[model samples]
Target chain A: MKNILFFTGRELTVEEMQEPIPDLHHFAVQPGVSDEPKCQRCGNETNFSSHPCARCGKECLYCRNCIKMGKISSCTTLYRWTGPEPDVPKAAGILHWSGTLSPGQKTASDNVLQAIQQQKEHTVWAVAGAGKTEVLFAGIATALSEGRRVCIAAPRSDVVRELAPRLQNVFPNTPPAALYGGSPDRHTYSPLVISTTHQLFRYTAAFDVMIVDEVDAFPYTFDHSLQYAVQKARKTESALIYLTATPEPSWREDIQSGKRDATLIPARYHRQPLPVPSMKWCGNWKKSIVPPAVLEWVKTKEKALLFYPHIETMEKALATLKAIDSRIESVHAADPLRKEKVAAMRRGEVPVLLTTTILERGVTFPGVDVAVVGAEDRVFTESALVQIAGRAGRSADCPTGEILFFHYGKTTAMVQSIEQINEMNKLGRQKGLLDT
Target chain B: MNRCLLCENGTEVDSWRAFFGAKAPPLCEVCTASFNRLSGPCCHVCSRSLEEDGECTDCQSWRKSIFHSNVSLFHYNEAMQDVIAQFKYRGDYVLASIFAEKIRTEAKKAACDLICPVPLAPSRLAERRFNQSEALIVCAGLTAAPLLGRHESEKQSKKSRAERMNAVQTFYPTGEATGKSVLVIDDIYTTGATMRLVADALADAGAASVKSITIARSGS
Candidate 1:
């Protein structure tokens, strides 16, 4: 027999499966669920096909909605164990981190624990570089000590990769398994799992605690299936914790309606303000390479990043800028040499580096000034602009850096990003977290 | 769990028996509907949709080699091209599984004792980490016997038809064959040159007969 492809908590087989019904308690679930090929797992209806199914040798309807995750059809049967539970080990020292949380982090961490205990929803409205991951460590440790299963899901693979090792380091006793598309840790039966949201489709009511980091990031916020995947992966009465640098407006409404209790961490871990962006109207930045203001800004800065909306324009600008300085290089979404370019920029060998929104989030270049060539472009949303600005002032050694937004005209996103940064600054100062 | 591989959307779609039966589709209705099937009058040898009538001149040379008839499921259109590219190049294993049931269904007609998929060169295998045809076989609920191996050579995609046909004879039968019907599998039936070479080698190795099945057929 082939080894069962057990992901999260769901058992899947490429072939038809049927186990003899053991004499046990069979509780009634949603009635009329298996009828009409409805996929109760994702709450989607079944799709009919005119072509004969190669497997069943009949014209059948299957759930195309969740098919990316092995298909769930009308005939697909799912079983769960409702037998007596075995005693779980209340493991001590699951978390062995030596670092201590700051006063703000401690407060937020306490709220996260409270939310997990109550099995309620909570959001950490932390700004960029606020040590959001650290805030969840206390809650995660508490859940693990109670013998509860926990999952930390992110939308992007890079974030999942970065987080898994950190989590495993903190929870040394329990080796946390990471799940991505081609993840080799698929078969590891661990209580703690760090996976991308897409991998959550294979799970069904498995996690007692589900923490989704970067909830507002791309693919997660925009993709409904991912949101549904998270819901399906968690137990009915489980705590749903969302950690994000920028929480959408719906989260605020949920908090207002008492659907959620949120802990807002506006200040960075270093207690410094996010660099506010200054806008300049440089007409048609596509034709202009190294504009006067941008040139002046680059000259004074030890290292800087020039963000363009399109790769074509960036290549043109990079070609023109190379004449001024041979150290200038550009990286885009598909640039094969992106890693080397970024590394060069970080080492200050590349005085000016051009990039796209691909480097908007989760990248930190200490004290490097940022300049956006096309701030008015739709590619630079309010969230992206704030994250680009966030790349500045990330290091405590240089907690203040310049961020310039050069565009043909100021778009609402640019204005909003600056406004959002200022608003967070005001909130940070009001809470006495920021130095005067 | 993921955005549709073909269309990057996450819209809800209905479940089909195929959706739930075995290997599920990683695509949406709109994307799946665009699968340009091999419909119209087909060439007997290559299974390509012939513009006029019966087997074209390409298969006339088959009498000299251990060539036989071939069947392809879909026409190599732009949409199918993208799907195959993602499966072969990008290493989307899920996409490869989506065709398993179809290939298995096709392989059933052959009723061969042993199934074999065209092998990748050592250099290509090191880079791709998989042979796409073998993955399809895995999805079809069968293990293909490792029968053939290839020498380090230029990729079929990079070479023209003439270049591919006249290119070095890379494939050689690696296993013994005695009175067993053999069906060769591959992702695409491009020039028939590689398949002909494999067929000739298989025949020389004492196979009863040789035939081929492919997921897509290039336009003649």
Candidate 2:
């Protein structure tokens, strides 16, 4: 068993906390990374960082930031990484290649490879355009070489469509089965099966290597039953790999504590830094056909996506935009021709496509700008906003673009999402892993 | 001396309950043979063993079941019926486990590829906070396949045999079973209505064959 540290007020080594289940955790910090920034109390700057606090000898240190926000009273906690890093076998045959893997991708792939070799569970979190699909090929190839059945499960049907061809090319000799609500070749069986997570429920201790992509996305992430189903489908000896861009705080804690093995990919695949979405307050935005500045921006943006929270507002927004310039079309879940309309936008037949969160994932274009009219809407959580912003600059043709979240009042999720994107970018830049 | 349940002539060996409680007096050999004959002739289709005929008259003919066979352990006597009701309503999970263990031994003969419990409608699951069939599966130490019963229909308790058969076709298995042999499990088998219908559902979902096992079989 791997050793991991857990903190509760006092710094205790992983060996100390032998309790079966712990209570509400304060913080899960990496072990031995005690580069304390500054002390809020006494305004004292401490450079001498050690396992134990210098003054109080307490391992938990409350930073100046939290103190300034009057949140320092809460106990500070640290979590140490515990999982083993195993080496994975190499990929066989001409592996399908459609994307690039930055240093972060290498880290993720390496972690996954190790997990597979050791028969341990691991998580790989890469920002959108981090080439999540490409990074997985090596690890999957490793598992396949060991005569293990690999399953790549996603939450969305569209994602399955996008990965089908790429996976088919990667495992060229061994035909992979694509399973979803509607797939003509679903009947054909293969060792490597790509299916929606819901489809996993039908299986019993089937896959030896189950890779759940977009683990933090809809359906799979939100539905408890679906999560249970994935676990049930996994054989007792199998390693479950969770891949996602935006992981919830608890999962991050689990990783920090070494309770779970996690590899973070903070950079995009193309080596270009992710575009940061600037916040704009369009005051009484509904009254105007288009704000002068926004209108000018739209005219210049050859390909752009407009997001509306509600269907009724989307209809009005589409009508208003069309009255000013007749090149706008709106699509929602209820739209009969949603697939066709999305296809049209992808082909550049329509310049601006207004949509809901339904288009938050799956569909991708080379270069398209995105704007959310109501950033603070109920549907747009921190996770949703990050995914929406991720859609802005994803393609090889147009890897760098802009994302705008226009709102009357901003929520914590909106602010947090921007911070997370910037934080990932900063981490990438610091490591010199940002796409050139 | 306690009498045997199957044959009143033999002395009762201490039951598992009495043995576990350290109250066992020694089993009578005659009682063992009598209890072994506890089983009776059941309906070929529903497992409701008949008295005169080998198979019950109701299910003598070939029926439409992807599940070609069915089996049950105990006859639905007052004690068994009471135990089932208590297992579900009184949260006596141990009883369900006991029932499942009995069913598992009986089902092992079939060698089914997968175990599918008769799905509880979402509405019933919400009300009870658990699936009765799921409890038995766990008790049986069987792998419970992920199959959902959608669109709530009339309860089986109120429906007649024909109505239950008609309603079974509507219970669709969400995913394809890929022609695997499936064994459906439930706590009790009444008119064999639920089993026949569940078999049909499995067949519709591309199951190659279906078989059923229940904790207890209802006597006519």
Candidates in order: C-alpha RMSD to true structure:
10.6, 22.9
For all candidates in order, the CA lDDT equals: 0.76, 0.68
- Against the hidden reference, what TM-scores do the models get? 0.69, 0.53
* Candidate 1 error regions (>4 Å): A1-8, A15-37, A40-50, A63-88, A253-259, A289-292, A299-301, A336-344, A347-349, B1-5, B8-82, B85-187, B190-220
What lDDT is obtained when candidate 1 is compared to the true structure? 0.76
TM-score of 2: 0.53
Residues B37-108, candidate 1, lDDT per residue (tens digit)? Answer: 787887887897777658878787555765667889998988888888766765454567667778888888
Model 2 clash pairs? A29-A78, A29-A79, A82-A258, A86-A114, A271-A435, A272-A435, B41-B49, B41-B50, B42-B49, B67-B210
- Give the per-residue Cα lDDT of candidate 1 at A374: 78
Per-residue accuracy of model 2 over B1-220 as CA lDDT, tens digit each: 6432222244543477766775322224543322222365545666665665466656755365575766777666766665666555533344454445467777788888888877767766544435677767865777788654756877777777666645545477776788699888787777676777777777777888988877776746
